[model samples]
Target: MTEKLNRFGMGASFVPAETLNEIDLGPLKQLVGEWESVVLTQTDEKGVSKPLASGWNVISVPGVPKFTFEVIPYKENLKFSTVAVHAGNRGPVLNGTQFDQEIFGLFYEQQIVSMCDTDFCNGRGFGKDTVIHAETGLLLYVSNINGGYNIARLGTIPHGNAILALGKSAQANNPGTDFFDVISALGVNLDGSIPAMLGYNDQISGIPQFAEFQQVHPNTFLKSTLDTIIGSGSVTDMTVLSMSTSHPDATGGILNIPFIQSNVTATSMDATFWIENISGGSEPEILQYSQTINLVFPSTGTVTPIIWPHITISTLKRMQPQPETNEPLTLSAQAQSNTPGVPQL
Candidate 1:
């Protein structure tokens, strides 16, 4: 948790004080329960842009919790319903919904939380704003608004500057009021930072370059090489050839290189080079290339994973069977039994 206060000077009259304990946060907590917004950057495949509305559900849990934001699609009549799980080590589950089709293309969503320490005297005080600084260099301003009016008018001040203003305003309203006698205050040092919401950029894109070659044996060598290429973070495309050959002279030695559409950017130029001696035969020789080149993306677009039917079927088989039962006997016991009968005699 971050420290809440700075050291005070010996002669200072007003010291940095705790603000959370002074004011009631019930109303503020209630106000953050559900929030909705429409994002204007969402677009479709046809390059058509549309507004996408998203919803959020906030909750406070034990310890410092990282809030979550969820994206929900619009259902009938433009309403949304979705949930966001906190990304921290352990936090409460937050849910959200988006029923407004006007904002469906928005991908990035976030949740924010705030804490205050003082009270405002019915909007008449100076301590009306709660200012919070985020680790990402973002500043947040939170204020109590009631029925479209600032809550300072109601003598409400939770934990920030507004609390002092409310106290002064209250003193001015009543003459002969002792500042120390009438002023009530509390302070709280909240431990978390404000959430920074982000969204996907439609203008950025990536393409993958892959190498495909035939194999001489059904060994793990091919698969291992494929894994190594991907793990290197440079190869974006891969294809395994089905053949057995050791020399480049064989028809099966043909290598096919293809470019795959990808959303990831290449981290290095190493992927552009092919394994010189893939066959690993006696007196192995490296394949000479005329030129090596790295392909760049010619246009901006996004690439989503294409779900194939075979992959889906394989995943379903991994799930455990429900309401399982043991196999029954195929033959009846009586039929298998032999007895000394008159016909046999």
Candidate 2:
């Protein structure tokens, strides 16, 4: 009995873990509950400050004169639920010893909507307050297995694509500095030069109010938001979770349906999430993430498939604390009896 409980991390003093206090969730615990996107401020050349939607998406599509580039600002709602507790995978036996790993997971749903009704270049973006994106997935916390990845994100998009990205995590005191460093190192350039190369300028995107956001690298918007938060000294610590399907150390990639695979293939995906802790504020915590997806499609002029990037970034605040779950793991004789040869567990 003692061994079985300890194996499952149910010690004598162990009590049911709630949303924010789950031991297996690690840094992902901060993500539980509801989150809503924020609105930042952007200053124009005219010295007038305008509202900048916290959610921004930039993508390129094949077009006539050149590829049509699009910049869309949106609002998002992300919610996480702790649906599983105490799962495991049994490894192969070697030299009379087998490796058994423990795992925990949380279910997440993401909904995004356009912030403006303006039309986009080549008729892409939706109208104001229109639902633009919907996604559901699982975030897993895997116990170490021979120095392998400890965290992973499994995402499914209605657009006929599924993503499996794996990586690691760490805590940092200076998230602003760390975020900037990683953004640069990961090839997410802040130069904002892709629009011109694609041939569609700000005027073509149709949202004149967001022209400034379109002119620079989409990440610049995220950097500015971090600067303001860190500059205010409100955030004291942060947990950085970075994952990539293309990372050499990790194993996983993107998959698409037949229709999507034939026209445009989603080759890879990478994302970084910053879970920040704020002191003495109405909102005790905030979550920010930057994600990039590589899309490859055949173009008429070039023999080589055109490689375009789809990037999305957002800053969200926690709406409320997640209610405590009374029993994360149920230990009952009736439950154990269902399985044959299983002792009282």
Q: Per-residue alpha-carbon lDDT of model 2 for 85-151, expressed as tens digits?
A: 4456677798999877767767777877767656542144355665667777788888668257878
Model 1 scores a TM of: 0.12
Per model, how many backbone clashes are there? 49, 2
What TM-score does each of the candidates earn? 0.12, 0.75
Candidate 1 overall lDDT versus native = 0.17
Q: Given candidate 1, what's the lDDT at residue 293?
A: 12
RMSD of each: 35.8, 10.7
Per-residue lDDT, model 1, residue 200, is 19
